[model samples]
Target: MALLHRAELRPSKLELLAGWLPGRQWFAGEAGAPVSRVAAYRFDDPAGEVGVETLLVRAGDGPVLQVPLTYRGAPLAGADEHLVGVIEHSVLGRRWAYDACGDPVYPPLLAAAVLADAGQAEEYFEVDGKREARPASMTLTGSRTGRPVPTGPVSAGPGDDGVTVVRVGDVELAVVRRPVPADVPAAGGLAGTWPGQDEPVLLAYAR
Candidate 1:
């Protein structure tokens, strides 16, 4: 289960992405465009430390961009280049945001989603002493190919033509930036349907 808090952020997630999105090699959006959150979903960190969430945002009229993020209590060492930014969370205090592709904790979970059919974590919001289950904003489904989930730390290469290749041991995954049917490498990968979009779109591919 994913536990969330109703808290304020000094620089909200969208604010952090507004500055970081332009620099991506795959970004094809116009300058000074409106960046708004479309929807989001979370994955639980088994260790219960990191906040793993995938954000879908639109910049102007461009295609929805898939921006997976990891929020941490401290800076992720050696990931300075992929660091999105630091923000002060009203409840969690200081939080470091990193591009999920560059974070070590992301690959295994992504592999599970692609090969093992793992779904996004169920969410619950806690306010005061009360806890209430919250529905997910989106529904994600795995390819369910039943292959062994990739292991080992991932080292991501630079984004090229809107896809980032993440290497985990012997498995290589193509993480799509702009989720589209054409980005699906072969047929097995993680696919999802969000609020506005009922048709499934490719999110990542394992090859």
Candidate 2:
């Protein structure tokens, strides 16, 4: 389960993304275009230390983009290159957010989810020191695979179109960074559904 706190965020998530997204090499939006978040999903950190969330966003009428982020209480060691920015949370104090593609904690968790056919983590909110269930904004379904969970840090390789190859341990996972036609199918992969979407959208494939 993913726990959320009712808190104010400095600079806000969208505000930060507006400044960061345009700089990405794969960004298809016009420079400085306003970006809006369409939907999001979260993955549980087994240790409950890091916050892992994936945001689906669009800038103006540009293509939908998938950006996964990891939030940490302190800076992740040797992850300066992946740092998104530092933000202050009204309840959790300061947090350091990084792009999950470069964070060591993300790929292994993703691999475990895909291998286990796990769903997105359920979310809860903290109120008066008590936990209250909240609706999950997104749902994820992973294709079942009998392979053992992948381990070790993830490595990136050349990709075609908007699909990127991320290696986790000995397994190669293909991540779709851009949204494709709804009818497109994957032989074996991770799929997700968000608010207003009737069909499952492919997110990643395990090879």
Candidate 3:
């Protein structure tokens, strides 16, 4: 389960993305366009530490873009290249946000989610000091193949065609930065559906 507080972020997520998105090679939107949040989903960290969230955003008239991020209380060692920005959460205090692709906790979880039948985590928000269920803005389901997946640290590979491949041991997990339908069936991967997109689209795969 993922707990969300009814708190404010000093420099909102969009504020951070505004400056960061333009630097991404996969971003096709016009520079300096206003960014809007479309939807998002989350995956829980079993140890209940880092926050893993994937946001779908749009800029101007550009297509929706996918960005996965990890939030931690402290900076991740040796992840300077992947740091998106620092955020001040009203309730959580200071947070270090990093690109999920470079977060060690993310790869193994991604690999397991794609290979197993794992689903998005349940979300709840604080309202009047009470926790209430907050349904996810987007829904994601993993392809269930019952196949074994790699565990432990996974090194992120260079992006190619809007996809980033990460490897752990001999296994590689491909994550799609731009959501699109796959030409063929997914052997083991993750797919998602949002408000405007009724059909599930391929978002990742184990290759």
lDDT of each prediction vs. the true structure? 0.84, 0.80, 0.85
Clashes of 1: 0
Per-residue alpha-carbon lDDT of model 1 for 1-207, expressed as tens digits? 889889899898888888889888888676567688888888888899999999988887888899999999999889999899999999889999999989998888888887777889999998778889998888887877756777776788865678888888778888888986544455468888877788888888887
In model 1, the runs with Cα more than 4 Å from the true position are: 182-187
Looking at model 2, residue 182 earns an lDDT score of 47
- Of models 1 and 2, which has the larger lDDT? 1
| Model 3 stretches astray by more than 4 angstroms | none
| Candidate 1 lDDT (Cα, 0 to 1) | 0.84
Pick out the ten consecutive residues of candidate 3 with the lowest summed lDDT: 180-189
Tens digit of lDDT per residue, candidate 2, span 1-207? 999988899978878888888887767776688888888888899899999998999877888888889999999898887889998999899999998877777888778766767768888998888999988777778867677887766776546777767788887877778865344234357778877875888787776
C-alpha positional error of residue 151 in candidate 3 after TM-score superposition, expressed in Å: 1.4
User: Candidate 2 regions off by >4 Å?
Assistant: 182-187
Each prediction's RMSD over C-alphas, in Å, is 1.6, 2.0, 1.5
Task: Tell me model 3's lDDT, rounded to 2 decimals.
Answer: 0.85
User: Which 10 consecutive residues of model 2 have the lowest summed lDDT?
Assistant: 179-188
